[model samples]
Target: MLISAEGRTYRQEAVAAAVIGYRFGASKVRVSIEAWLPDNRRRDVDNLLKAPLDALCHAGIYEDDSQIVELSIRRAGLDKANPRLEITLEAA
Candidate 1:
């Protein structure tokens, strides 16, 4: 969460939108995710997408997460040094 000087706490979706400089407004969406993990430990991919999807909504890429009609996720292998997530969002 990011707190504004005005005392508004920005969500991860809003922060990511501001950082990536992208926005969308579509009735339906498809998302592809690549998660680079720090270790080989197993985790649920669905758990990791909530914040990002929320961020997309905050960025006005869509009116709400319910617009996301398709979703895909995959492990992009290990990144012991700098784990990160890569996402691709498509609207229809």
Candidate 2:
């Protein structure tokens, strides 16, 4: 998702943070985000899909390789106070 804030458009990585779990369901569904940084260390966003998610996905993504699966990558925006970059795998 693309977001324009303070006269500037910012990108962000979005992920499912908490999957809705049934009281008796065997497994729950969840959304996750994977953000890659220049340092090689990756940032992961999970269990929380928020308004910033799309922005998040747009923020950090850098490279993607498509073959058997589609991949969208970005930088890392793990911190809520401030975000840097983030990536995501699109829903089929």
Candidate 3:
């Protein structure tokens, strides 16, 4: 099965983020994810919208904020064997 995920899973980074939020007394910390949907940039797929959220675990966490994030006129990691999808996270 194929799947896509977005999280600051690195143990140290996640821990540090939590620590910072705690220090600031953020009761309801905001975990925001800014991501690019896809870059099939071939000019042939207009409705090529992908549900990258369906591939994410925290899809419902911010359902009321925004549904998805998308990138345009750009392509990432066309040379690597396994490319990573980047999603920005701001916790707190």
Candidate 4:
């Protein structure tokens, strides 16, 4: 699939963030994501999953995205000043 310029940038940043003292082996894991939107515009939380997950995998956070046995995502609220995603991974 084609990733837009913004998406690519986001993935790069995500990978950089994941590589900072964060690493996981080939194990089942749970992922939780808290999304803060830049605006209150309508959006689907599910739409926010792929890029970061893919970025983490690219960063070798785990063996693969399939190793994510459990996943959860929620909108923490709007952060007009700084919209972002807070992702956490742990053994399942």
Candidate 5:
């Protein structure tokens, strides 16, 4: 699939952050994602998964996205002042 420039930038930034964060070895992991939307617009939480997951994998956070044994995503209301995602990765 073709990634737009914005998507590419997001992935790049995610990868950079992952590099600065923790890294887990090849093991089962649980991922929790809390998304703060920029506005009170309809958005599917699932839609937010792929890029960050792929970016984390690309950054070598773990072996691969397949290693994610459990995943959780939730919309934590609007944060127009600072829209962002808070991701937590831990051994499953």
Candidate 6:
């Protein structure tokens, strides 16, 4: 996932802090991601994960993305008007 400046800004402003609050330490972790897109847009899950995972790291949710021991990705149907991404990070 190549995040542009605007996208990085959005993640920093909108999600970083929340991820920090929801997470614990710099321990090895497991992550599950579910992205409910707004339309029938084709997206690469691996590519999609790069930015958010980077955001989580920047938020201090973990020391680094390398700390992720197990990762799962799902293209969870479409939510049209309410497209959203759900991420679950747990101690591994």
**Model 1: colliding residue pairs:** 13-55, 24-61
Tell me the TM-score of each prediction against the true structure.
0.72, 0.22, 0.29, 0.91, 0.91, 0.83
lDDT of 4 by residue, 1-92 (tens): 89899989988887778777457789899999999999978998999998888888888899798899999999999899999999888888
1-92, model 1: which lDDT tens digit per residue? 76454423436535654565545665688889899999988799778887766666766667788887889999999999988788787765
lDDT of 3 by residue, 29-55 (tens): 233333333443454322322433322
Runs of candidate 5 exceeding 4 Å displacement: none
Candidate 4 residue pairs that clash: none
Best by TM-score: 5
lDDT comparison, 2 vs 4, better candidate: 4
Cα lDDT, model 4, residue 71: 98
Predicted candidate 2 versus true structure: per-residue lDDT over 13-67, tens digit per residue? 1222222211212222123444433443443434223334443333332121121
State in Å the error of residue 40, model 2. Answer: 5.3
Residue-wise lDDT of candidate 6 within 16-80, one digit each (tens)?
45743766576889999999999986778788787778777777777788888999999988999
What are the per-model C-alpha RMSD values against the true structure? 4.6, 13.9, 9.0, 1.2, 1.2, 2.6
What is the lDDT, from 0 to 100, of the residue 75 in candidate 2? 41
RMSD of 1: 4.6
Q: After superposition, how far is residue 80 of candidate 3 from its true place, in Å?
A: 3.9
Error of 3 at 75 (Å): 1.8
- Regions of model 3 farther than 4 Å from truth: 1-49, 65-73
Q: Which pairs clash in the backbone of model 3?
A: none
Residues 55-80, model 5: lDDT tens digits: 88878888788889999999887889
- Best first by lDDT, ranked: 5, 4, 6, 1, 3, 2
